[model samples]
Target: MMINSDNLCMSCMKDIGTEKQCPYCGFHADSKQIEPYLPIRTVLGNRYLVGKLLEYNGDGATYMGLDLSTRESVNIREFFPENIAQRDPKTLGVFVMPEKETIYNECLQSFTEMWRKLMRLSGLSALIKVRDILEGNGTCYAITENIDGITLREYLLRNNVGYISWEKARPLLMPVLSTLGTLHASGIIHRGISPSTLVVAPDGKIRITGFSISPVRSARSELKCQLYNGYAAFEQYGFEGRQGTWTDIYGFGAVLYRTLIGTDPIDATERVTNDRLMVPGKFAEQLPAYVINGLVNALQIMPEDRTRTVEELRAELSASPSAVAGTGVEYEPVVPVTVKKPVAQRIVDEEDEEDYTYNKREAAKKRHNRSSAVIAVCAIIIVLAIAFLVLWQTGVIKIDNDTTTTAAAETVEVPNFVGKPYSEIVDNTYNTKNFTFEKNEVYNSTVEEGYVISQSVDVNKKVPVGTTIRLEVSKGKESIVFPTGGIIGTKYEDAQKYLTRLGFKVEKSIKLNLDNEIPDTVQGFSLEEGVSYEKGTTVFLFVWSEPETTAPEEEPTSEDETTLDDIVDDTIDKIINFGRGN
Candidate 1:
């Protein structure tokens, strides 16, 4: 008889009786699996399997797996303790309580659903769901798209490799701000926003993850334990947990501060009482004033004192002088040469060392010669000074001043040229004495074809003479003609790329139907055969479903049909008693 042990393999549910390791995957039988389970190999669920035992405080044992389906690899999680507890419900509940587990499971399910709805509403791709029950276990599995880069915490620990320069931090902060805006608008507060949860992708995209401990209105009891130590707001620690958009605002500010200055924000409670908060410039002198001010507003103790929304923060950052002029570096003028003098030079007594040969006759002769020379030099200098003055006054020795005068010619004002033709403006309007025109193409909803959609400088703004006014000419509404490029039997991914290059976003959907010749190809599209849409419009594509192949129409021969039925019966028999005693 097979004796059941506490260690059960999640995959086949087999007991390696008295053995310290799994006979199938070699997973250590005695090790606790949740924290540092060694990932073993790939499994049938399109997953990279990590085999180990899982423990539960509330939620059940989780098996970690890597999903290979998406453009980027994703981390998949599976709960195994639920199955083990169900098998021996009487004894298992004594050790691993079931009441709290059930509550935690329900909370996880609700949070997952909420996340799915929010992602969909925000126009982000829905996370892929993996079927767990079909694997003949109570284990539930979920797949989340994996980020290619390091976590924000890891990034900071690396001495902020990418964030040391402000130029690098600007692009990094944009997405963080954008995501916060989306989360805040949905009325779901991310009470915990820290470096560990924010993952930076290889493409410079920042994705916020790890919502396991996140609080929802449905799970009030779990909120108390959900407080992240360094990241949680002060209101979260109080007896009455106060969570709002401001909670996330404070977190976002903390992340920005840590990224810019290599330091975290002060505790919320401490900041609330303290009048003065440290700014970014103090820590990193290279930081610009506008950026420092923006961070300060975001980290303000009071919600009302902080930026109302991420968009407002973005606008403030955009309008700052530092934003347009780049990081602000203060300039110090050079001191004048007249005010600085060399140290006093030491004098030598050369006369005292000279030979004692003082002759009165020679001295008298030298004096007479010196007087005659001085009289002659004075006469010559007087004539030269008179001539120089005459020449300077007459402008003969004129000095050419290169400095520009205040009354220099001014630039012509740019007129409202939105409705004017590109060629007309290029040839006539901007071809005036002091101005020139440069053309650029852009998509505009209101502006007509070939007309100026916008300009770099506003209308009536004065610019220096010979300045080139940059103009954005309307491309009229962007349009794309559908392609009939791929062969009838080409794969979906290749076909999708072909359409995407022509300025169309592809949407994939599977349809169940029967077709022998076409098998599983781009069956067709929702749009008409010959219709054009504005560029960037989503094009939904459908692939043939499994039913088309599973239930084929060509009648089988007697012997063949019988063989197929026999195989089906065997498969069903194996599934029914896969893990049961023989």
Candidate 2:
């Protein structure tokens, strides 16, 4: 944070002297090593004073500057890729070699369009505030409001002990998702969202910057991507890969991985074959299992394999029992650990308020942990005290009504039932007298199916000779049974509702197989009209494709659809279902 009223360091947005390299921030005022940079105090457009060379980037170098027109401090980005063009020191104008002129112009257009698109999102709060754009000094310049903030990377290195608990990480990331969602809705792909691009402003709001330096793709499928080893997704490595929301999803996941693990995750390219990157749970075992599961799924190298949107990734993070509480703390494991999510595909493209019985089950997975260590300790103390009283009452310590001497030592500490094979521990941990064991099977993504996910009572606690304890065993991931009832001839929406209640994501694809007259009913589904699929699986619903324009010339005159309205209904159904994706 070097700032001087007279001069400033461009790289750090700090105030330093006019020298070859900044003495205070180490910014190169005359960066001639990799490429020649503008000297200190160089003026752009005759109205902006360049103070110091900030830092070099893939597309250009950013610098600290002053707007002589308005007398305001600003940060400026200069487009100068040495591979494509050269800056004429005498004229301060960019000149491209004839052979490379085409690529240079196209890339320059992409760089300019990137900012114009950002300009459309002026109201978005999570975006770093910008001031203006200028064309001069042999390259374009993107000047933004001077921000003295710390990059998320710097903040992590300085503040993180290791993994910032979910308690602290969720709130920090939620706003980012909401912002990306807005960007997606705007049809803009941020292709850049790593720890380095995210900054925490002085106002405590996290803003994403470095938009001007986004890589410009060439016609040859060559991607000159801004590489941040662990943070860049696999698709970014080449032009053949599909780049979209999923690309950013991987970057966001990698950032979380670094935050949670206190180590850099392996690059997506390496994981395509090896997949040796450690899962989030391995580093923070106590983290709600969904967080681990989400990170793993998001980092999938295959674009189709990753969660498709920021919303989905956010949901996966919030899927944990702790996140639903929205208390910003990881809840104890008193309830089932795994939360059901729509597998990996999106049935609903956008946020729809439509009702689905399938989503309701999501609210039932949260409950407080009933067996903490303190309660276990107290239970032991009470049990031991009760035993002594029983001995006295039975005349072991004192004479009883019949003066008979009897002694009994019948008490044992409750054995830990969590994480053990339910079958192996059930008979041994149960008490014969007052206590009993109740077995419950629940779908848990983290714990192995048939293993114990949680126990009703704490371990190491003495409960009389027997106390009833219930164990929730992992049933693995959830499955859904598509109801076979009344789906035929039902409105598509109605079928969507019915199947959703059965715990499946419902999708409609135009039926390639259609009848001539029109189709008023759902012909069939991809699988059995009624069958089971893993929960979160997308159930494809098929409907007849719409007929060509004009009323089919003459109705099919089919027996059931003998009337005119029947013909209309079928055509309408086709028209509606035709709009849905396959």
Per-residue CA lDDT of candidate 1, range 1-582, in tens?
222224445333355667776787665554332222223342535434444322121223344443333223335444323221343333212222455566545655554564554445444321122332212233344444444567777776877343455677777767667766776676656666777668866765677755443442112243223334335555665434445676676677778777876766566655555534454334435665556555655665555344545665676556556443443322113211111111111111223322222344655587699899999999999999999999989989876688655767655455556655676555331144346778899886556567777787787676776778888998878877776545236667887888888888888888676655454577778665547888888888887755543555897787666577888999888987876754
Q: Write model 2 residue lDDT over 1-582, tens digit each, in one string.
A: 222335555455455655556776665554322225666667777666776555553477777778776767787778776556777777767888668777777778777776766667767788875667787654687777777888887888887385576777878877877888887787777766778789878877778776633353111222223556677777776635677888778878888877777887776656666666654344546666667657766777777556778877777777756544443334233322122332332433334533223332334343223346568889999999899999988878864477765456455456555765566553321132225779888898667667787788887676654567889998977867767667766767878887788787888877653347346457678766456678877878777666645554665556645678878998989988889842
Kindly give the stretch of ten consecutive residues in candidate 2 with the minimal lDDT sum: 216-225
lDDT of 1: 0.54
Supply candidate 2's per-residue lDDT for 484: 65
TM-score of each: 0.41, 0.52
